[model samples]
Target: MNFKKCLRCGCFFASEDSVCPSCQTKDEIDKNSIRNYLANNDTPQNAESLAFQSGVSIKNINRFMETKEFSPLKNSFK
Candidate 1:
């Protein structure tokens, strides 16, 4: 079995996921907030701006971007 530490919780888990299940739930919530913010607003935002506006962390946003989960908003960067 492969064991890896979760980036968010720093707990070791046996999986290929970057974050553990608990942190994944929280990340989902954050993602929803970011999506809602993007849907409701037209202002261009970069990782830092999005983090500030959505109350999410820059690390999480960058991770999402890196995984291409937030590719639609990638072009919104200013």
Candidate 2:
């Protein structure tokens, strides 16, 4: 089956569902929210370095990356 991730909680589930189990209790944003989140975040490497230096958890950073909500680094893989 094809898979589409939940924009609210970043959980991959049955796309037919109206909401993700994790974010079902809270308000869920539409496609616009996801685009905005991606644009607002995902800064440059300098910011990522600063966040890391300031003690942001690797897990959280990675989680954000997977969400497609965070665009912290443009050329992160490079």
TM-score: model 1 vs. ground truth: 0.86
* Poorly placed runs, candidate 2 (over 4 Å): 1-50, 71-77
Residue-level lDDT of model 2, residues 2-77, one tens digit each, is: 5768755677887665446765544233334434544676543553553454344444444445544455443553
Best by lDDT: 1
Q: Which is the leading candidate under TM-score?
A: 1
Error of 1 at 19 (Å): 0.6
RMSD of each: 1.5, 7.4
Residue by residue across 15-77, what tens digits does model 1's lDDT show?
989999899999899989888988898645578988898899988888888667687667778
TM-score of each: 0.86, 0.30
True lDDT of residue 35, candidate 1? 85
